[model samples]
Target chain A: MTQPAISPALPADWRDFFALTKPRVMSLVIFTGLCGLLAAPGSLHPVLAFTAILCIAVGAGGAAALNQWWEADLDAGMKRTAQRPLPAGRMDRESARDFGFGLSGAAVAIMGLAIGWLPAAILALSIFYYSWIYTVWLKPRTPQNIVIGGGAGAFPPLIGWVAVTGDITLMPVLLFLIIFMWTPPHFWALALFVKTDYAKVGIPMMPVVAGEKSTRRQILAYTVLLVPLSVVPWFIGGTGMIYGVSALVLGGVFIVLSTEVGLRSSVPDDAMKPEKRLFAFSILYLFILFAMLVADRFATIYGWQA
Target chain B: MIDDPRTHDLELFRARQKSRNRVLGSILGALAVLFFAISIVKISNQSHKKAEAAAAMAGQH
Candidate 1:
């Protein structure tokens, strides 16, 4: 067998560097950040809120770029990521690394100056958590990687809350927990479908290391935990009954999907159906939950706080 | 390494340069759109608040 080349031709184009940032993922992060800002009780200048969201987006993008840079080798081996900018020889490793670092640093500094030091500090911590702790240390080491690394994705809403309030509270923490618990089920569903891609790349995702049965069981367990957790914001009065009802309905559907994924074995070719359904519903679940939070806030303004 | 014939393929080099420029242009263009959208929203919000205040004063009279 011929030896595979390690580093290929470098893409001199700047867009290749941009591709490393994962703009699609950044959009969700920015949206959650905006929701956090809008739902907070405190007031913020419009410009300042915009600045905060921008910084969150940039910081998320930067962390993503760093992740791609670090995982370029693994990416090359995985069919799903084989065509990524770094792995496809569309960008050089050193350049991607530098771009990630520059964006992380600049985002933190701009946030500190334009917003406040607290939010800026949180932004910096999130970047470090994602780029260094999650991507570098945890991801390749253990199957529990996504569990602990999920905190990085969960931080945006908390950062958005802090951007307005300049402090942490139980409400923001609840919001963080909602996303924290939501991450595993959402990602693992995708992982179930993509296990082969991960295994081919030598990455030890839960499905690869523990087998499909265990991964399915873990997904169900997380979904069970997530249902109760999603309803907690309403119980604690951070949100109202509109959110409570939405959470209950959405969470119920999520658990049903998870159970189906767990119960079915030797699924027909199309019967991995539950996994795809769960993945699609998971996105809608989070969106509806956050949208309810915003809607409930407006309801309170209109004398429907309950 | 510097004298490689592949590096001196002028047409390929020009094509790469053109693609790079186009990508950069699109990114800057998107950023411009985002900036203007945010600016317009802020301006409209301020105007709405002003109108609300004026309406409240008229009602008080």
Candidate 2:
């Protein structure tokens, strides 16, 4: 815990604090949550809907802050994470911890009061899952951290659905599963290219614990499972052709890219193109998939070709 | 309280944190008030609609 090397007087700017929120990751959380709310059968008050998304964002930020707080020591050793506010010694650990708790507590309280309790309850659980279960327990100990911990990221849409419907249903659950299955491959793609970082930091990422060959095989396997699972919503009439077709096409590309990643033996610096492409496309694939869901719903409402 | 020299810096940190918390607390308080006002307006609007419907029924009678 003693980072004796960092100068005590180094000033922390507001951006350093903002960096703790993991804004890029929160964007996907917000998008998915919004899609869930919009795709639901009923309408919500716009104010309440905004509040729900805000809560999700704040909860995610808090979880990320806590994750950094706990892993500050581990992060300092890794080049990828060394510049994080905590690891960089731009912010004090106590402040980071307190900030995490404050944001999480406020988000949950506002959610329970302004919206419904179920979503708030799930939001709390999601934060706990990420900070405690994944960051604290699984990440240091096991190679399968993201596989099980992906539930933390999967909860936003489910929470958003519950916020609208005030209960669990099959559709939101399927959306959850879609993201859940998608996580391993998406993360493993990044992990494959960044294996050395994990190895250096002594984190048991799949690529570090298992060989790259095994990691690539698992990535392909998850992508294969994810493709069919993503289409389940359309098959069950939960979504329309817009989402169905988009998912099928996007999934085809995902399979092709992942297959290439799996089959390749040599990953030269310049030739790691497949992994890079997969990582980049995975983000787009999810964003487009969710966007199509919302578009499909609107199309159905207006009696347009969906 | 025993004045331990080692905790002097921590005491200042806590004081700073307390003031920051107070500011955040005030913002949350304002938000709670806004939500309360919204709820009240919604309830009043519903009741006003009910009263108008009742008056219309009475006139028909």
Candidate 3:
């Protein structure tokens, strides 16, 4: 008689646990959080600043893990997410959930004890925003999920700023708004291309629910709003002309590219090059824009106002 | 018998568990060091503030 083959019940790899944190997404969170710390009015001890950014990153990771835990079924349905640890059956949902809660609680406690209460409170709220508000409530139900969901990513900068200044200010709020507004156009461009995956999984992403035409137009609309909003920091003397000019140049390019995506009709099987271009440039745009904010601060210290 | 696949699988699992434990151990150590540093900084900052307040009071007198 032939022996029946059995697969070894192996434990999940350490890398799979790491992957649950969505490290790629965490990079942007860390960058914005650090920029917020850098751009704030007062100074923080370097160790404390590192701790603040670390808390933000860990909190975001916890939230991402929770998101994956809740969406495992939906993730398994979509090609883009089918390979995730939970979706792929490499990690158990219970482990993911435990890891999420542990990281989140540790991060919040450290933030409060090491930095201050306000930033810690905001850190906890951002985790709640992403895990409960965006993931559990909004995403499955609303086509406008990304709009409201953008708030989760916006808090890092605000938290970082508060860690330094220990008080809320207009500039950090503007930083928050820039991310909030930039999110819709940035996400929808990717949605325009991979909308089929979302549709298959019933996620109600704008492109999947609103159709490409409406999605494109809205992407352009948000870009138009974002350009002016980004330039506001300079207008109000919150930032120098370095950031101002960079924002203008970057926003101009964003508008031109978004206009292309906004104005054109995509063919059923086209490469979606414009949407792809906008998506790539949008990432570059925010990185450069925030970098300019820091650069402007550096320049002002060296006596270069212009 | 010396080359059984189940033994290899068990060995691999043990190795992964060991690696994860090491990482967790390292993180806990780092957290202890971090908390110590934070406590020191907070104490120093409080003392600095108290000294400034005392100076201001003396100036007022």
Which candidate should be chosen as best, given TM-score against the real structure?
A: 3
Residue runs of model 1 more than 4 Å from their true location after superposition = A1-11, A267-271, B1-61
Per-residue lDDT of candidate 3, residues A226-297 (tens digit)? 999999999999998999999999999999999999999998689999999999999999999998999898
Displacement of the residue A89 alpha carbon in candidate 1, Å: 0.4
Residue-by-residue lDDT tens digits, candidate 2, A113-182: 8787999999999999999999999988999998988889999989998999999999999999999999
Off by over 4 Å in 2: A1-12, A267-270, B1-61
By TM-score, how accurate is candidate 3? 0.95
Error of 1 at B60 (Å): 27
Ranked candidates (TM-score, high to low): 3, 2, 1
Q: Is candidate 1 or candidate 2 better by DockQ?
A: 1
Docking class of 1: incorrect
> What's the distance in Å from true for residue A163, model 2?
0.6
Pairs of residues clashing in candidate 3:
none
What DockQ results for candidate 3?
0.36
lDDT of 1 by residue, A1-306 (tens): 532234334347766776788988988898888899889988877867887898899899899999998999999998888999988887778888898998898789878876679999999999999999998999889998999888999999999999999889999888999898999989998898878888887778998999888989999999999999989888888888888999999999999999988776544454577898888889988888888888988898789765
Q: Is candidate 1 or candidate 3 better by TM-score?
A: 3
> What is each predicted model's overall lDDT from 0 to 1?
0.85, 0.88, 0.92
Q: For residue A101, give model 2's deviation from the true position in Å.
A: 0.6
Model 3 chain A: which ten-residue window has the lowest total lDDT?
A1-10
